[model samples]
Target chain A: MSRVRLSFTPAPVHVRTARLVGVAVARRAGVAEELLDEVRLAIGEACARAVALHRQYGLTELVLVEMSDGPTYTVRVIDRAPIEAGLGLAALPPDELADEALTDEALTVGVGFALLAGFVEDLQVRPVDEGVGTEVRMAWPVGR
Target chain B: MDLSLTTRAIGEHTVLEVGGEVDVYTAPRLRERLVELIDGGARRIIVDLGRVDFLDSTGLGVLVGALKRLRPVNGSFGLICDKEPLLKIFRITALDQVFPIYATLEAAISADSSGSGSGE
Candidate 1:
């Protein structure tokens, strides 16, 4: 049985909330502060990337952050973005950015993802829809 | 994250006493304040970060940006980061090569005047 899902906008203000809840989860799971920082940075960077991508598309209904109790912890940002996971960004340079995942001309821009991928431990991209919709799934190890 | 910055002028040197966390959120306020100070003819600056509890990459970016802005004018900038964590960041990022790191703001000002720390 997973925990309650907490959904909120991925704005800068909401990033703080996600961090706060993340701290609580880290405390309960006995994650170290250093690891907690990595989690916060990765999640914040992910949410920031999501928000910037969907800026011209008005906004998503809301970003869903689902937390559960298992061997590992996960944070997911659900947005109806027209992102394709088949761009093969797994080997792209982390110093720069590979916006090939974004088909939209305007959306395929920025160094936000470069920073995000470089910092996050387990970075994954999945196409959760028919040729669109991206769910950036990241996992951080527990037990410090 | 409240930032309280105080300026003290000791002869030809300008010292900035920065307090609170310098991150992506609070760095904008500092950037604006620095721009104002530089515009008002305060050239040589020593950013006293002894009171600052936290600083991030964005904050580092602002500091680097300030240094870039001041360098062409022959104005110099230094940081007072005696704390371990802050000092570690400077060393890790190799920013210590770009900007002088001093034990105290007073030392930086003194060294600047004596020409010992003139971009050494």
Candidate 2:
């Protein structure tokens, strides 16, 4: 299995770089061309969510991204924010949550996850076993 | 790519031309510009994304925030996005139904100020 690991400070600017790197790795892993956009969007959303949480909590730790290609291409974004932030996102209904998110600042972070879920068919949001944060795991099938 | 935003008056509509990528890092600038336009009494606003190469949920949130901001004043807000990749993002997020999207800037500018247009 081939693996790529990226770590960056939880800043908005670095999120773009993470997306670019994630897409490059996905392409090299044989992810389909049409699915590249989805991969890019998913990575952006995941990293953005991590950045938002880190900023909200005033934490300066680096966000972790791991990409692995085996039977399927998998990308994982790990954020060191409170577990509630990530767990709460999966429970919210994207459509109804999105309508109210415009007016509500607290609901804004969840909107990103909603978009991530929409873009990635295979998605998992859960807490890290050894940390106090959440992990956003997404996978797409490879053509080769 | 860096995000570029410029606004110009087209008839009664103020068109905000957006180019480059709109992500978490740059969305705040777009949001601030939208707020400035609304604060400056731009009632009919159309964001032209034909030149935009990338857009994320943060960008979508900025647009949605602009729409909500204009609603209290009965302002009209629309978008011009023709690219399939960008359109797919809107479709996936279900934002296509929320925003009046036009395939061209002309369609958006000429559409009924009432905010109805042929969207792709």
Candidate 3:
């Protein structure tokens, strides 16, 4: 397996840097053109979300992106911004929350996890460093 | 990558041609331009994304915000994008139905001329 890693400050400008590096690495790994498009969008959203989270919490830790190539392509975006209790797990009643309300909230809440889930084959969100921060892990089959 | 925006008036509609990446960093620049155009009495706008290399949710959020801003005045907003990557994100977020997307700049401008520019 081949691996690539990048570290950058939790700044908006650096999000594009991470996305470019991720796409370059995926291209070098022989990822298909159709898949590369998805990969690029995925990385951009992940990095953008990380930057927004760090800015929201006033955290200074660097956002780290790690990519691995093998039978599958995997990428992990890590941030040090603390995940609040019951965050991203609330199950809102469809009757109570209007679609417009949800869309408005999504603007400030970072990239929608549902969107990411639709793009990648496998996606997992978990607290890292003893629940002090969050890690977004996503992977896709290499030949797909 | 950096973003560059150039604007021109197409009849009563304003066309903003964007080039380069529109991620979190460059989205604010686009947002500012959109705000300026709208606040400057631009009632109809067409954003040509043919030259845009990238767009994330941050960029989409800006577009959505612009749409909302124009709604109060019955203004119109449209997008010209044929790129699959950009289209995919719009589909994933169900925003494809929210904004009228066209294959070319001329089509987008004319779309509003037909009195079908009001956003859903």
Candidate 4:
């Protein structure tokens, strides 16, 4: 199995760079040509969300991305922002709560996940096991 | 890499041409430009995204915010995006039904001339 990992400062400017690197890695991993756009977009949204969370929480840690090529090409984006006890367990439906009442930053973050759901077919959002924050895991089929 | 925004007046409408990627990093610039136009008394606006290579949800949020800003004054807002990849993003988000999207700049401007901003 081949794996690639990227870590970058949590910043909006770095989100685009992460997307580019993720797509290049995906292409090298045999992700289909037609699906590259989706891969690129999903990576951007994931990285952007991580950046927003880090900024909102005033955390300066690096955002983490891990990509592995196997039966499926998997990408996992991790943010170091603190999460409420049960917030991560609920799969971040903050979309519904986003409608009731939310700060502008929260709404912006919420919309990113909504877009991720639309772009990634196989997706999972969960709390980190060892530390604070959320992990957005997405998988796409690959051809060897 | 960088976003390029330029505006030109065409008849009673203002066409803002956008080029390059529109993601979280670049979307703020887009939002700022839209605010400037609205504040500068631009009522009917069409964003030409024909040159845009990439657009993310943050960019869509900026466009949606612009529409909201223009609605109170009965201003018209439309987009010109002929590229299939960008159009697919709109379709995936169901925003294709929300925004006035045209295939060409001429079509958007002509639609404005007909007293309707409904795009193609």
Query: Best-fitting candidate, measured by lDDT?
Result: 2
lDDT of 4 by residue, A1-144 (tens): 899999999888988888999999899989999999999999998888888778878889999999999988999999888766214322234223323244445445555666688889999888888878888899999988
* Model 3, runs deviating above 4 Å: A85-105, A108-111, A129-131
List the global CA lDDT of all models.
0.63, 0.84, 0.78, 0.82
With candidate 4 superimposed using the best TM-score fit, by how many Å does residue A10's alpha carbon deviate from the native? 0.9
lDDT of 3 by residue, A11-126 (tens): 88787778889989888777887788778877877777788778877888899899999987889998887676213633233232224555644653433554576688787778
User: Model 2: residues >4 Å from true position, as ranges?
Assistant: A90-107, B114-120
TM-score of each: 0.68, 0.92, 0.89, 0.90
Best-to-worst lDDT order: 2, 4, 3, 1
Per-residue lDDT of model 1, residues A1-144, tens digit only: 246466776454565566568657755766566666556655655554555455546665576666555666777665566665322333223222212232322112222344446556677777765536677777666673
Candidate 4 per-residue lDDT, tens place, B1-120, comes to 589999999988999999999989999999999999999999999999989989987887788778777877888999999899998877766667667899988888888778778332
- Candidate 1 lDDT over residue span B1-120, tens digit each: 467899988788888889976644576788888888888998888899989865655566567666666867888778888987667555544556667889977788888888766543
User: Highest DockQ among the candidates is held by which one?
Assistant: 2
The DockQ assigned to candidate 3 is 0.39
Chain B TM-scores, listed for every candidate in order, come to: 0.93, 0.93, 0.96, 0.96
True contacts kept of each: 0.00, 0.44, 0.40, 0.40
Please identify model 4 stretches exceeding 4 Å from their true place.
A85-107, B118-120
Specify the poorest-scoring 10-residue window by lDDT in model 3 chain A: A89-98
Worst 10 residues of 4 chain A by lDDT: A89-98
Model 2 Cα shift for residue A55 (angstroms)? 1.2
Q: Report RMSD (Å) for each prediction in the order shown.
A: 6.2, 2.6, 3.0, 3.3
